[model samples]
Target: MRNFLTAIFSKDKSPFVNAKAATSWCKRLQEIDMQSQHLKIHAAVTAFVSEERPTTLDSLSALLLIDDAAQPSYEAVCYQYIANPRMSKEIESRLWKQITSFAVDMAGVYQLFVQSETESGKKAEFALLMPKVLARSLHYLSIQAKWHYFRFEKVPSKLWTLSHQLYRLSEIEGCDSNPFPLYTSHAQEVTSCADEYIQMLMLGSLSNNNLSVRQIDWVDQWLNQWSKLIQMSRKFQEGRYHLCVNLQAPEGVQKIQAESEGEPFRYWGLHDLMHELEETLRRLENGATPRDLGMGKECPAPLAVELLKHLDIFWLMSIRNSVVQRSERKKVAKIADIISGLDSIIGHVRFDNDKNVRKASADGRGQVDYDEIMDMRLYGFVSTRTKEKPPPNKVVENKQKDWHVWNIENESVGGYGAVVHLSENEWVRPGLLVANRLGRQENWHLGVIRRLNRLGDDEVYVGIQSLALSPIAVSLYMEKEERKEQISLAEDSTLGVADLPNIRTALYLPHQIEGKNVNTLILHSADYGTDKIYRVQARERVFMVRLGSVIEKGVDWVWVTVFVISQE
Candidate 1:
């Protein structure tokens, strides 16, 4: 009442003063005694303020701008309360809710701008009237088609830098908000393909709010692209790298001495091969004198050929007597061929080094699974798009997730082996960011897809390396009964995050990686203090992880260690 009287009677009631008064009133509402009464009173007050203003697109845009303008003052006041422990926390929670709520609402507005079929063919002529809608629509469209690369993927799933593009386009072309310089041109350039039909729809978006989409065809196009990639990636989903191999090449063929361009080796000697075979057998027999295969005496070429012919017939007969499951040798080869072509985009083929050389000493059937392997049912959610340098602890928060229920095949210290269905595994890939949660628990562990394996026609077993567990829930104050009753309760929480200060580092991987992959990544200064992002170049699987990050004094230097996790 005293504050209200001051607002009415005092000389100063300027825009800033009125805004300050409104903010103070809102802040005071937090101090109301009863939780129920507190929420109810504030709700009534807010509803009253909103009552006079109808929330059209324009009104919402105005409110958003106003909220943004007032944010700094709220933050300043929040900072002022830093020394007061309780009030500091209370102020922070209020600020977070305001900011988060605004963001959530703004996201809805942007989505509406792109998706509103009713608003098709509407020319956004007046910038002052519809700046938010126009700006966001143009921004999102540019992001979908990166300056150089055009993603055939879903719009919301893409990432890009469009602030400069939007500003320039808005100022220069005066088409929509920021005219997409190459969006329409790219469509015209792809006239050779039958997919020109799809490109036409893209052109519609580039021109105006006229998105003339054929729903069935659009879905088919999206699914077809995803399906082909998934089919190519299936072999990789299973423990594809652990395939059994014959260590020594089939013997007895007449040596074909050959040399190719830049070949490291040429003309491997027959005597050297025989000696190598004898030595390997001696080691296998545990230093017992190996049964000599007459390697000491060279057999005539005719006799060697005859022996090899008989051996080939025997091997063919053994394969004919093999198990009922058909070999996927041809399909595996097809997958590898396709993957090899796209090695520049998706990561290179990473082979597992689980050389079960110990199996030669065993019964040769294969190692058995132990009972201790935890069989927990869980869901793994994969992020749709790739990130070069993701923000810290925000892979999951950065949306558009496709999730699948997977059976945890086994558990390890820092990782887990899980099986996902064909529909699910299609989206999963090595080095891709993923979130794993056991059952329905909200708790999630952020990680990378370390490996993928295919079992048969349906299932894909994947290896996951956990980086960090999701932040702890702050709702511990609520009892189980209370939680059940008030599941949709308006909760207040504070993030104890420090200010972001710039720092620098160098990219020097501590682990041993293949020579080809080692030099592929060059950690740019722009990526310093960014999230642990996964980026692969050719065969190079790259990401940055911090070992001892601290805000150092004097130089403001923060040392974040980088790592390249791969198998040789």
Candidate 2:
């Protein structure tokens, strides 16, 4: 009450008083009562003494100018706490929440501006509002996006300037905040949906081998949901940041209008979304793990399909432009053909370097060579669209040999080599191995040894194991196994397939993935391929282990453990 009186006597109403002047007052108060922390409380109570609430008439006359320059002081306070441990822990905690609150509110303002201008058809207002709203929007998004990227991916940089700018554009174009919570909640939704779609794609990719009809339906559903969610997210961003304000106006307030001025904002909004979606797809394919960005391990297939779809659209658009420009039809046709061919090739070709080769001396006394052959198979047509029912399981013939001698020159014998040619369609399963000879060459023995040793040059060994031990549960495990060693786990019979270690990894599932109450797990191992003793099963929900990864010579194997599903 005494402090309240002090505020009533004081002159300023601004939240922040000069710290130097306040410090002396604080010191004096501390001497009065160490337990008393009423400075701010008193300040709040007396804040209204000198400040009068705006009257209804006055409010009507005043412009609601969102002061973008008036950055919330909460951010500075939080930064202070983050940079200094000497500050009171209580102060830090309070500041963190305040900062987050300020950020959300600030973003809301920009969103409001973007939405208002776009809907109003005030092109001039939108043009004028664009730089300011976008600037602030980018600022806020960069901060949040960086936090996520850092927490999840451990990316050092906190700012993706380009992405921030694009996000601003997206927001102005149109993004909704109704469905998900503002911060991580919204982020999680986008990532989780993306992940689900990816999973569907993966299942579809694997379906040609042995997946069931029900499994295919699940994939299709995922794809549909994934496309819709992405579309929604894209719409939100585009709608929020795209404002083309006019320069000439009576009140100097420009309004936003469509490029053509005939159509509504939705077209432009969708266009912006498409641009961002394509960019995101490109990033995922290139394996660029941006900071705080959580893209779930959904199959790459859907992404590929989406990208191809856009590519086709872009191609048609480009062709239209070319025709208008009177550009050479033949050149345009060739470009389109190339794009179509690339789309088909990427759709069907999946390359994996998972096999290793080992050879010994003529007398099997010393290590002669060890190589790993990365596998790549070509399919006639592989759709990115999810299928409702998985194709019937079939044993696709793998018409390739375990080892092919390209060139062999023995220490004591003549050089002789021949290429192994594929004569039939190969049924390549999840764990199948297949190899073809490059061609015949002189010094066949030496060439074979060299090729085998070369596998060591580009080998990344990941181990997978699953076993049925009981009727209830199947255990699973995954671990990074870098060195070669003889590792073993008992196969439980009663539990059915207990676990499948590194199975998700084998299927290229993302780390820290969860689905339908199924927990993915990981284990360490020292083996790979047909040589590794393990089984694969799907039915009763089982524990999946995705290991905490540590980088090794890119060629290390992972260990995993799994046990049967158990009601007990």
lDDT per residue for candidate 1 within 357-456, as digits (tens), equals 1123245574211111100100123222222322222122223233455667676656677665656446554444455566332334444455454554
- Prediction-by-prediction clash tally: 6, 126
Instruction: State model 2's lDDT.
Output: 0.29
Candidate 1: where is the Cα deviation over 4 Å? 1-49, 52-68, 71-96, 105-129, 134-568
Error of 1 at 183 (Å): 26
lDDT of 2 by residue, 1-568 (tens): 9999998989653332333333344444434432233323233323422243322211211111212112223334444544454657687556544544445444544555555555666545456335434444544543443232211222122233332333435444443221321222133433222222222222222222222222333334334333333332222232343222121211111123334232222211124334554565567556654221333333344544443343323322322222122212111110000101211211211111111012233585632111111101011232232122232223243333233222222221211212111121121122221122223211111111011110121221111111111111122232333111113233345443344344422321212213321222222223333223333222221222223323110112232222223311
Q: How much is 380 displaced in model 1, in angstroms?
A: 42
Per-residue error at 527 for model 1, in Å? Answer: 23
Off by over 4 Å in 2: 1-69, 72-75, 84-93, 153-568
lDDT, candidate 1, at 8? 83
